[model samples]
Target: MNPNDPKTITDAEWRERLTAEQFHILREAGTERAFTGKYDKFYEDGEYMCAACGTRLFISAAKYNSGCGWPAFTKPADDETVEEHRDTSFGMIRTEVTCGKCGSHLGHVFPDGPPEEGGLRYCINSGALEFVADGDE
Candidate 1:
């Protein structure tokens, strides 16, 4: 496996790198409790990146207070920033979002977003993201 590539990293390696909560949310496709995420109320100007692979996923400009108990975004950094999969887990049809580069589970996307901004809410997990405040890196 390429040490520099997230896509090639083994599960053991990922376990070594991520915390238990992060592993559960990112690797196991688990969901964090609503309103418990650090970024849920965080509004710093920055970019949200994939925690495992450091791939830029969302920008602060696209983020909004959707009151959904999680960090909500109008869109990704780009069309290829994240991938959406039809999730049927737990008997509910939802769209699962994942990091485009490493395929780490980010969260889910819902269609009940503000209609003005393309009407899509990218409800993402804070554990799946690392906020890089503007001018910090």
Candidate 2:
């Protein structure tokens, strides 16, 4: 909320810290249109962190192609960076993913993942993540 208060940032501060597009998607829960996200075709070894909070959410090793027009992962980078809750939004039942540290909405988890593992898919929006390139590792 309050981006500068350290507890939570004010909406005004968030607007200043992020571009209009980032703010719209991150703070306002606006979805980036399908197939247009930067990570849709990405294939590199790195970690994906929260764009707003810098908390690591996924590792490159967990990424996969679900043809869902967004970056998808079979699992999170770690179990601690995300929290899952049952979402009843849109009149459908689903598992919602949020940041563990700041509670920023990341995306949702589905059961249609790669069947070899468990068919669990963590469908994430690329706008929700800030990828730290492998070179930075």
Candidate 3:
């Protein structure tokens, strides 16, 4: 993606596409409940994309069993698909990951992951993702 890409949807489009709660959480960087996300028990071969911008963020192959009460991924589908920011909110220093295309806040990334490849855990919110199962219409 280009460095000068626009990172938001039109106001009308956002209003039409999402509910108030979804818009607040996905677009405004709000957080959802710990175990209330949709993808916490998701186990399928597919791609996880940003609900706001449809940007492919994680692949089924990259998902792992983190047991952190959330869907975990060891790596993103592509490095550029998600952008990381230094989040100092909530009185903690964490790396926040958001969709690069629309800047929708998904969740945070942590270094205390399995000692496998990448060695990082992308703890994501299910409200921020849409799973497209493999070979589904």
Candidate 4:
């Protein structure tokens, strides 16, 4: 899906479309516990898309093991695929990352990443993503 032309899904539709855990994370901006997300340790050749809207966000090449208990990507598939906002929750300032297409909370981005790899860590929640393996479709 194009991030520029986001779909307008309603709350009722979202609740029905997603699982409880997925709804919590994508719709209510809730987070899954560290080390418990499905994609934290998943490494494969594929693309990661927003779980809610299926917008392409990250590719396997940009993913790395950051030991951050979440899927980490050095960069997005496209600059406009994700959106960032200043988050001041829990007494900490963070850059929250969301799917630009559906405006669903994906995770947060941090500055402490491999300097050789764009110097950014996009710490994303697995519950917020759906992976499409290379050659799968």
Q: Provide the overall lDDT of each model, using Cα atoms, as 2-decimal numbers.
A: 0.95, 0.83, 0.84, 0.92
Scored against the true structure, residue 6 in model 3 reaches a CA lDDT of: 40
Q: What TM-score should be assigned to candidate 2?
A: 0.87
| Candidates ranked, most accurate by lDDT first | 1, 4, 3, 2
Runs of candidate 3 exceeding 4 Å displacement = 1-8
Q: TM-score of the candidate numbered 3?
A: 0.89
Instruction: Residues 1-137, candidate 3: write the lDDT tens digits.
Output: 45345454566667688777668777778877877788887889999999887889999888877888888998889979999999999899999998888888899999978776668999998888899999974
The total number of steric clashes, by the backbone 3 Å criterion, in model 4 comes to 0
| Tens-digit per-residue lDDT, 72-137, candidate 2 | 999987779889989887899988888777676778899899998668899888888989888895
How far out, in Å, is residue 80 in model 3? 0.8
Score every model by TM-score: 0.96, 0.87, 0.89, 0.94
Query: Each candidate's root-mean-square deviation in Å?
Result: 1.0, 2.4, 2.9, 2.6
lDDT score, residue 103, model 1? 93
lDDT of 4 by residue, 25-117 (tens): 998889999999999999999999999989999999999999999999999999899999999999999999999878999999999989999
Q: Ten residues in a row with the worst lDDT in model 3?
A: 1-10
Task: Report the C-alpha displacement of residue 98, candidate 1, in angstroms.
Answer: 0.4
